[model samples]
Structures are given as structure tokens and as C-alpha cells.
Target: MRGYKQPTVSVIGASGYSGAELTKILARHPSVKLDKLYAFSQAGKKTTDLYPWLAVDMTYEAYDGEFDSDICFLTLPHGEALKLVPDLRNAGKMVIDLSGDFRLKNAEEHLRFYGREKPDDACMTYAMPELFHEEIRNATAVSNPGCYATSIILGLAPLILKPQDSAKVNTVCCSGISGISGAGKTAKTELSFSEMNDNIRAYKVARHQHTPEILQTLGTSATEPSFGFTFTPMIAPLTRGIYTILNIALDKHLPVSEITELYRSFYISAPFVRVREMPPEILHVAHTNFCDIHVAESGKDGSVVVITAIDNLVKGAAGQAVQNMNIMLGYDEALGLT
Candidate 1:
């Protein structure tokens, strides 16, 4: 991240959903020199053998050896960061952590939800570029936001930038089909075809860990994260994407024209978020790094509803992680990520 050279990047957990996605993007980047891919569980195996689409390239080695890339993407699970970042950062490699570990600020707060172990004292900066691009621009350690939290928080983040004359949002988001793949490329009873095909049940209820993350990112403790959500998640048969719908209550009556102005003003410089009048569809952003958002309101009660859609594995995970990497390296920010 310190030099002007094309970055040498590496992906850990190379066989997982986000890991493979990161490998694909980096392998083609004109400025990113993809060094290696690592999957401890599938160590000593060819990545093409696992994710057949890769087809084994000579220019890059997949899971063949340990690496010393300029930038490292940790696509591991929550607690896994506690084990990897210290070693990588000590070796002077910039790190973009895609798990939940570094996103929360305090060690005790992090350990409370992610079990008893804590990550090393990391000076981690939030990596949702639209909100923290200034901070990410010079950070050595970055923490990407969760899928639900990214869509939910960013969908309504525009309202927070200004004094909401009285915008009170009551959000009820039904996360789309692809989140199960996010669960892991593993075998689970709930993820089985038999149980998931036509069945949908809400797991994690009121205690979903992402709940606090959404609140913390979007509102102040004094302002109150009174967002009550009916967050029902289903295992859809689709392979990728997350769509969130937030039903909001505005503090005062505001016109749609005014809302559009506010949204555009808030995200004019953000290249990935598209704020629209019509509802955002999953297909519009299925394979890209875009978060398409839409807003609607009821005049009678001053209520507004926001819809946000993103490819969970891309904008919600690897793509956004790379976006953070670009910022941290002082690159064009959108380099290699259109």
C-alpha cells in the first residue's frame, strides 16, 4: 500500500464464496498483481478443481504456497481474523478484513458476540466507501460491513446526513435467496435442497448480531436506534443477491422531489450506489458492485419506504473489500472495479 507499484494481492479462504469471487476480480485487474490463493481445508489442491470456472492459470498460483502480497483479503469467518491479522500486519502487509471481527470498535464488544476470544488491537477503519471513504483513504486495516447491515444502513443513510425534520424509520427487510451460500460452502440441514426449496423460516429472530451493527452505523445512541425490524430471512434457490425493503416513518411531510435531491446530494460522489425512483431489482445488480436504492412515501402519515438491492457476494463482500483496498492504496478508488 506504500509504493506506487501495481499491488500484489492475495486471497485467503480461497474456496469459500467470497474468496473465489475476490480471486476472479483480482486475477483480471490491470493494476492488481494477484499473488496467491489459500484454503487451509483444501490445501495442496488446484482451485480450478474446486471452482471449475477458474480453469487454472499459469500467471497466478492457487493454494500452491504461502504468500507475501502487498494487500491481503481475509475472507474467513468471524473469529478467524483474531488468528490471521496480527501475523499479516506485523509483516507489514495491509489488510482488508471481510469478516465481522474488526467492524465493531471495542475488544470486549467484539468478543461478546463473536465468543470469548478477541482480535489483536487493530486500528480498523470502517470500509463502506460511501460513508467512510475519507477514513479508508489512508487506512492500513479495513473492516467491511455485513451484507444486511450494508444494504439496510446505506439505504437509509442519506436521511441521517441531514437533520431529519422528523424522519422515524420502521424497517422490515426480507433478505433474499443467496444468503445461504454466505453461510458457507458447507453441508447443513437447513441449507439442504429438501428443506430450502419451497420453505422459508426466520432464523436468529431478535438477537441477530447484524442488528446492532445496523443501529450503530445508522444512528446515534442519544438519537435512538428505535428501528424495529421484522427481519425475516429465507433460503432462496437463487445463487447470488440480497434485496432489502425498509418501511420508514418520516418526521415530517416531505415531497418525493425533495427526497431525490437529498439522496443525490448525499451520494453524488459514490460510484457504486444508484438512487432511483422506481424500486431496485435484484437482477439490476446481480453480478456487479452496485447497490441500487429506491424511496417511496405515504403522504398521509409522513412515512417513507426505502428499497436496496445488492449482490451479497460482490457488493456485499469481496467487491466492496477490494474497493476499500483501492482507497487504502490511494488508487482511483474505482480501479479494476467498475
Candidate 2:
């Protein structure tokens, strides 16, 4: 008991959207100790100095040496993450990744989408604590789902993962705009305020990369040999949080009440998800880690619609990573996460 070392956590690429959020959250997380926070730009600077709002009563220190932590959080971009994950594992640090690097199972899939090599043999548990909780609990490395995938998957996993009737399904999702904060501290012409303010437009029609990640995770055992989808994203005039509306196509009809009952019963064990009576408002879930969901149907058509919303950066990324860590550590599954 006297020799115990606090489990240390590090944030690599801590200057970006998801990275910064994770840094702030982990800085205050109770069970885990904040070991090192790294940023290429603000490498030598202090955390409070870079993001004054962090106000955590800490100074920004340089990543002057190798970091040793029970777990390391990667907020790096997809391409960069592949390189970092393998080394981190070799160094014997368990990992929790917030990027898309390790989510896809096939290496070629990673290459096809991001033009990057798959991290070879760097096995990681897909970190969607609800469906893959067991895998995560024993896994050495963890891959967090993409932001959009988190909202969409949670909205539909109960039906798709273990389809009650094994009927086929389809899905659609929409996300709100966040401040350039979501884009990170980096500079991008497309994400500039002038272009994003007071505007709403769907960018990637069917080419959003997250589409395949979503389909891969949620559409696992469907019988259809080929699938078709319509996915579109818009830039809402907000700073953070993504409001997503997803519709799931079911081949068989289930009563709206039964559907609600099923969802309520299905997610009863999931802490961060809430099944609401009326469709949930984004604001209710906006600064929190909750995913508020509502279900509906036209009755005649064998289709069901699920509307879900969340703070894209939270439940969609950092918060989910923490949830996976809680599972992996066998701590209170909700400890320090809620």
C-alpha cells in the first residue's frame, strides 16, 4: 500500500480539438493522475498558459522526456496515430485513442480511406463500452469510435448489433456546427469564422469516411450483400456539441411502445445514454456526456427512426474514452466518467 504509484495518464497531441478537451478532463479526473500533457506548438509552454481557460492551477511544462503512465490518451490525427500507437504499446503503456486510427479492423480499409498504413499487430479493443465492454475490459489498447459514429452507433446498435428479427437496416445522421474549437487550434480556410458563421450546408454527400466506420460497427451481421446509404453533414452555428438525427430502416414492424420498451430495456445498463419520452433536445445533453435518444415510427411502413444528440467532443470522443478506461480498469464502470 505504501509503494503504490498513482496510475498516470498522458495526452499526446494535446493541442487539438479532442486532445485539448481530454487534457482538461483528465487533468481533473479523480482516479487517474495527470502525468504529462504534450503539444507540438505549446510543447514547452504550460497548460494554463496555452488554454488560459483551463485554469487548472498548473503550469505548462515541456515534454522534455519519455512519459510513463498506466494509460496514454491519443488525440492525434488518424495518420499520426498509427505511428504513435505501436510505440506506445511497445513501451508497455495501455492506450486509449480518440482518433479513427485503430477503429477499422482491416488495414487496407484504413489505407483506402486515409491513405495510411494500418498499425500492424497493434491490437486494440474497440472502445464502445456498451457493445464491446468485455473486449475493452481485457484489451491492452483501446480505439475510440469516431464522433459521428458514436452518436449514430449508440442510436442504432441495439437494433443492428443483435437485430431482434434479423431484419436489414439503413441509417442517416446530421450534426450541428461547433466553434472552430472542434476544428482544433490549427488554421483552416474552410473552418474559418467567415465561412462557418450563420451557414448550413451539407459537405460530403456520400463520401464522409465515418460512413464506413459507422456501417462497419453497426451494420455487422446484416444479410444484404451490398448496402446503400445517404449520409450528409451540416455546419450549425454553434460552438460545441453535435445534434444528430438518425433514421434506422427496419424490415419488420414493431409497435412504437414495444420499440421504446426494447430500447429502454436494452440501454438500461449504459450509464451515459438516456431514453426520453419526447425527442431529446441537444441542450439537455450539450455540456454533458449524455446521449439523449427518442424513437418513432409511421406504423404502416416497417421503418423506425431514432433521434439522438450529444456533445460531439464528449460522448462522441473524450468521454467515451474515459468510459472505456473505467471498464478496462474494473473501477466503478461509471467512476470519474459521469
Our model 2 lands, by Cα RMSD against the true structure, at 2.9
Q: Provide the lDDT at 204 for model 1.
A: 64
TM values, all candidates: 0.90, 0.90
> lDDT tens string, model 1, 72-141?
8888877777677877888888889988877765555555555655645653787889998889887888
**Overall lDDT per candidate, in order of appearance:** 0.75, 0.71
Off by over 4 Å in 1: 55-67, 107-109, 119-123, 165-178, 221-230
Candidate 1: global Cα-lDDT? 0.75
Clashing pairs in 2: 46-60, 47-60, 177-236, 178-239, 179-239
Error of 1 at 25 (Å): 0.3
How far is 174's C-alpha from truth in model 2 (Å)? 6.4
